[model samples]
Target: MDNQKDKILVVDDETSIRRILETRLSMIGYEVVSASDGEEALNIFRKEYPSLIILDIMMPKLDGYGVCQELRKESDVPIIMLTALGDVSDRITGLELGADDYIIKPFSPKELEARIRSVLRRVDKISINSSIPSSGIINIGFLKVDTNKKQVYKNNERVRLTGMEFSLLELLVSKAGEAFSRASILQEVWGYTPERHVDTRVVDVHISRLRAKLEEDPGNPDLILTARGIGYLFQKIMTSN
Candidate 1:
């Protein structure tokens, strides 16, 4: 495709699913490439360097989880897994493997499009935030966040965060001590509507991921705090350095 929009790599063993997504996503302005198997998907991914990937869990040669693990070793590109398994454990496995999102099979085209736009929007928002001069720094003790560089450093050592994890951290730290409800967080962070009835556990999952990356003690985080009945909050607010 010869389009200016961010490219999407869609990986599925099912030809029909790939064709449907390719047609629908292209209709909404995303430049899309479809792969019939995981091996081909990885080949195209390396060559095309797509902005995002829509990977299916079951495929020939290699599975989506393996593909995700492989890709994460080299890049932090956004990933959204496609799965027929609706079990919570399967979804958790995908998230733990660094996927940004997941959609079950038989998903609505509109919902899928919304998810694609949402992921891209988060990436673009980070870019925009990074461009602002005075709003770039957040230093709390030994933890330093540079929104301009899209980086985090703890005790002077660089910390690696996936795209979704970084977005969640940025949202909380940008407004320190402010408690955000799970529903509000879902809407703001993941671009989910209340009407969509999205699982709020997605928010919980990301929070756990962020804690693992940024906290000195993931079990008892001092920075990102639980608000009990409300939601979650960034407890400290040191002046931007």
Candidate 2:
């Protein structure tokens, strides 16, 4: 069981919810640290540097958004936001603030655990394969992608990207000019199956975030283009070094 220990930080104002998550996650081989609010969560985060964070959007003494913004300034640790609001804007806001994933409140424990597992798997997979390249250095005009380093540089300056963001970009660039539907992207990037009733907007949110980080003019992206009634496709590399 020593090998199964991955510390998880659970941040929520609700005691019952935190207790429930702590118990359930602990049972499944994770070491859980519970925080009642965003401030406390941030304190614990700096100290523990947990493997994953389960954050609540609505919390006293600094909301999840603020904590996320603060954390993004230094860390790219995976964050799964818990929100009571079902509005698409709220979900997008969380993603824009660097949350890896979001789940609506009143969700089942199993579903939350599944999301945690999916996110951790993606993070771990990226770290393990950082040295391997699916394709060599791809040059996209002013942007350069060093797949071997799992890095992207814009005008020679490194562009910061989260694990999932890089994964999404890599997937698109891997099959340049090939339109990948939202459902396909969700399956490939998020490990969500077609049988699962997952929101396709997740793909759109991630794509929008990628554009913001990687494109000089996110308003009119040139690298990743929308296929209009379909999905998105990356332009093929015109040069490679």
Candidate 3:
């Protein structure tokens, strides 16, 4: 028996939902562990070290936002927020807290499963590709992006970035000065086509997060620039005498 099955931590306050997910995900070959509330979720996470987390937003003793924030402090594990709140602001809040993605309540099981697979695939791809040799380092201003190590540094000090964040940066940096539209970025980075009515503000949220970490003045970013009417682009590094 292979012990390498991807472990998933399902955190929801609803017992039925937990049972359903456990059964469904287990049938699909994942090892599913669950917690009924936010605090227990954290405890289980520490012990299980799951490959992914499907976290519900509303719960007692803490909340999904708290869990996501705590996890981001140490782990870059993929998080997909499940929530009853359908407001765009609520979704943005989850994304801002480092959640990799989100799904609203009454979601189709198939859609949720697909999302799970997509997030996991991204994680696997990043892990495998980071081990391969590539362009060593890209210097942009005071920042150093080490492609080989999948790490970044600012003024020789290490900068913490989630795997997804690094992937986004790599995409833009790979084609510096090339403007990538939000739709293209979604296709290239998230491996999905945006639905006509689906809010693609996720891309903007992530870009903001990246700028907060990478730019000296996030309000007026110098490295990652907005390509007015398009989307965004990485500014070519400028050399000063």
Candidate 4:
């Protein structure tokens, strides 16, 4: 939440672009770190461990996708890429490489600021998810998830979960502990706010990931059971083991 401590790494090849971005971000109270190329960007990233990254797709020495692939293998930090090409394919590729969001070249300063804030907020929530204590953990005899603390325990053992997956589990288990529609789940868990629908496949992926880690058998899920045409449910724990 501290703008000073929450650093932003702007990686771009063009000097003018970097200068403009740096000035804009700094004016708005953000601490800006700039890199000329992908290689330099990686160095700064490793040294600074910035909370959020604003990467440009085209760069010298190393391209955006290559750098992103390397970074994602190590950390799950939020990344919002800048695509000079402004092509839908480029955006899709960036997303495929674990980017949180993307903006075309010549984007608005206000829009950039908004995206950065959104990403940082989510990252902050994720950091707290594994630490804070929720009101309660949805225990379903076999599995348990503490929504407040964002911790998952299965068979009395703590289980690791990704951020989005944890959000999905919390949404399902905290509510009626019953099935809900996929569209609803996407809206609630993934923060899909726009009128245009999001990729429902994303939910399917997260659910599969949660079941694999929490359930003794991921194929046949008991904690997150599917109801035909309805959605999925997190059966409430009647008795704790």
Candidate 5:
């Protein structure tokens, strides 16, 4: 029960919703912190340095988007904006503003829990990758992986990635054309043991994120390929396209 592992922040104007989220998240061993509006959220965010944020797009002051923008200026903490089911614009705005993910309103608590667990797992994987030893850059086609610096580049342009995202990319690129199973990815990327019931759908979410960051076209991905219900493959980008 590491205290640092449990840190989270919840921002929503609805008192009942906030209270419910606080209670539910706390019951699952998270250090829950809540704020009613964006202004207070910014203050608490700076003071606490939370690991993840559950933000509401609509608020009285500052709003979730503003809060997300302010936080993005300081850190790469994961954010999940809560938006209405039909509010398509806010979802785009949230992602464009550097939010990590988003959730529509009336979401099931279980889904939220799954997302939290996924984020925590991904963050943990990133921490481990940073400490591993890498002698030099590993390149496949136009993709360049620098283990020593823990950096990546495509055709000379630097590509930004979170810790887990980088590890996942490196693994696939390191073994280009070989498709891996969901469980195989969990064991290799996350270091999760066999007994753990870790949901492998997390792998899907991460691949999506990686595509958004690395692909010229996320819809028809050329780098990260999905094998229906199987897993993913990393295609070498031989000469820019």
Candidate 6:
């Protein structure tokens, strides 16, 4: 029986928000560490190495986007951004910067907890699957996907991808040539059910991100293709002898 608690890093400028989250999350069996600004967040992240991060967008000295971008450069630890209400652009920016999820301000602790669990669950699933002995390497064009290692390489060079990005890619590559609807992708990749009605833009942004990293030409992607009316698919790469 593993009794180890998941550690979460909460980054916010507000003392109230940090305190509230720390208290509530601790009560729910998570080990919570917090920072009042982005730089502090990075420092704490380096030392604490939390399993997940709850990052606030607005902060003194480096903001959430900066921290997210910096973190993405070296770590794939899950990140959940806390954005201001009605800030669609902010949410999109956070997602583009490799945040796994976003929650608007004034959100209930219960809702945040649910989002945290969902994101962590996805990460855990990937970790467990990667640990399986049957997992093997997948070759698509110049790309190499190692399911056991949960890593991607392009033209023999490693491509840095966030955990969510890798999960999405793994799903598509696992069933190449299958068109997955955006809603279906949300359900399968993000672990959101149909009734959850999650914004499909999350799917689009992640697809775009993957293309930018894996495709020779993101403007005309050869690997990840749009299915016209349905959604998207990973093109089946044909090898010539």
lDDT of 4 by residue, 16-117 (tens): 989998998888778889998889988999999888889998999998888888887787677778887745566677766666667777888787887787
lDDT of 3 by residue, 1-241 (tens): 2323799999999999999999999988899999999999999999999999999999999999999999999899989999999678988899999998888898888889888887777655543344223555767789888776789899899998876788888888877888999989877777777885454777898899999998999999999999999999999773322
Instruction: Give the whole-model CA lDDT for all candidates, comma-separated.
Output: 0.84, 0.85, 0.85, 0.72, 0.74, 0.85
Scanning candidate 4 in windows of ten residues, the lowest lDDT window is: 126-135
Order the numbered candidates by TM-score, best leading. 1, 3, 2, 6, 4, 5
**Per-candidate TM-score against the hidden true structure:** 0.91, 0.90, 0.90, 0.68, 0.66, 0.90
Worst 10 residues of 6 by lDDT: 126-135
- For model 6, what is the C-alpha lDDT against the true structure? 0.85
Model 5, position 122, has a per-residue lDDT of 61
Which residue runs does candidate 1 get wrong by more than 4 Å? 1-3, 126-135, 194-198
Indicate the residue-level lDDT of 12 in model 2: 95
Question: Residue 107, candidate 1: how far off, in angstroms?
Answer: 0.5
How big is the RMSD of model 2? 2.8
Q: Report residue 118 deviation for candidate 1 (angstroms).
A: 0.7
lDDT of 6 by residue, 93-180 (tens): 8898899888888888998888788788767664444322354677778998877677888999999888788888988887788899
For candidate 2, the per-residue lDDT at 69 reads 97
Question: On lDDT, who's better, 1 or 3?
Answer: 3
Q: Distance from true position, residue 14, model 6, in Å?
A: 1.6
- Looking at candidate 5, the ten consecutive residues that score lowest on lDDT are 125-134
Least accurate stretch of 10 residues (summed lDDT) in model 2?
126-135
Clashing residue pair totals per candidate (backbone < 3 A): 0, 0, 0, 3, 0, 0
* Stretches > 4 Å off in candidate 4: 126-136, 139-169, 176-241
